[model samples]
Target: MEYQEAKDKFISTWGSLGTLWGINKAMAQIQALLFISTKPLSMEDIMEDLKISRGNTSMNLRQLMDWGIVTKVLVSGERKEFFTTEKDVQELARVIAKERSRREIKPVIKVLDEVSSIKDDGTEKTKELIKQTKALHNLTQDADAMINKLMDQKQNWLTKSVFKLIK
Candidate 1:
């Protein structure tokens, strides 16, 4: 495949993958663009190249910055801000996992705690509710443990975990 075509395909594929991770299409597309760019990209450059609207580019860039994956840079004497992403794939994945654990998993764990705390009224339905919520709570706890391990380790978390398990 040709250069531009390959770039387009990569951006599309990455953007589609982002949707599966609960982010919007434009956000993922912008991430993919920043990932492959050698230099920082301005909002105008991003909109023009991605064929996205100015507002969309602005909003998604802000969101990316909030996620700590993308960051803004100043161009010497230029007013417009240029953006770049965390280039290391492992570091990027770790950051995303930490953020998702904070924003999404924590809340689910809270809800599971509340639901699992319901008093036993001696009904089959109540028993079932408690049982199911307990199961969900267990799963969330495991997820939380994994996220914590990922965030705390500097390198080879999986390898360390495997060794720990065997020992």
Candidate 2:
């Protein structure tokens, strides 16, 4: 298809995928747009391109910046801010994995730790809660370890080989 059509499809798909991952659709759309753009875009440009309001664009851009997926670009001689997306897929995945681990997995692990450490009351409900929390803690800890390993592997050839083999 044509370039614009392809971009539209990409934005739509990315937006939907973002929703599935608990990210706002508009933020993902803005990310997709920046990812495909040849140069940095201002907030106004993003608003116009996405047909979203200033507040919507501003809020989403802030969120994306906080997540490390987007960065602000200060064009020389220009006062308004510009934005760009991280284009490297591996880096993008690393950022997203780290962010999710911090936001979701870490808190769950904390709760699991607290609940599992409680002194046993011998009640069935307490036993069940402890058992479930322990299991969740183990699972989340494993996931965290795996993510850490992957992130640490960065440019290691052995790590790349292992990842390929696993895949």
Candidate 3:
């Protein structure tokens, strides 16, 4: 495919994938645009290129900053702010994984800990509920550990030996 077509396809696919993960399409599109650009982009540039409203672009950019994947930059003599994404894919994945774990898994683990700690009321239903919550707690904890290990890995952490260990 041609250059423009390939770029558009990438942005659209990325936005759709993000939507599947419960993120808004506009945010994903903005991220994709920033990632593909060689230099940091101003709000006007992003708005014009993506055809997004000013307010929508502002909100998504703020959210991206909060997620630690995007940053605001000040040019040497320019007044307006520009934005850029963490272009290193490995670092980006590490940040995203940590954020999602904190947002998603941590809460479930906390709730499971609370509910599972309740005294047994002796009813079969209550007993089952407690048992299941404990199981969920264990599973989430394990996932958290795996994510931590994966994030802490260095450049060559994934190897034939790693696959063998998993297998």
Model 1, global lDDT: 0.90
Our tally of clashes for model 3 stands at 0
Q: Candidate 3: lDDT of 153?
A: 83
Q: Which pairs of residues clash in candidate 1, taking residues 3 or more apart in a chain or in different chains?
A: none
Across 86-146, the per-residue lDDT of candidate 2 in tens digits comes to 9987788778888988898888889889989998999999999999889989998998978
* Pick by TM-score: 1 or 2, better one: 1
**lDDT for predicted candidate 2 compared with the true structure:** 0.89
Give the Cα error of residue 24 in candidate 2, in Å.
Answer: 0.6
Q: List runs of model 1 lying over 4 Å from the truth.
A: 158-167
Query: On residues 1-167, what C-alpha lDDT tens digit does candidate 1 reach at each position?
Result: 99999999999999989866668889999999999999999999999999999999999999999999999988898898999999988888888888888888899999999999999999999999999999999998997987788666888776776669978
**Candidate 3 Cα misplacement greater than 4 A, ranges:** none
What lDDT score belongs to each candidate, Candidate 1 first? 0.90, 0.89, 0.90
For model 2, what is the error of residue 28's alpha carbon versus the real structure, in angstroms, after optimal superposition? Answer: 0.6
- Give TM per candidate: 0.92, 0.90, 0.92
Q: Write the per-residue lDDT of candidate 3 for residues 1-167, one digit (tens) a residue.
A: 99899999999999989955457899999999999999999999999999999999999999999999999998889889999999998888888888888888788899999999999989999999999999999998998989778876866456646667988
How far off is residue 159 in model 2, in Å? 8.2
On a 0 to 100 scale, what is the lDDT of residue 153 in model 1?
Answer: 81
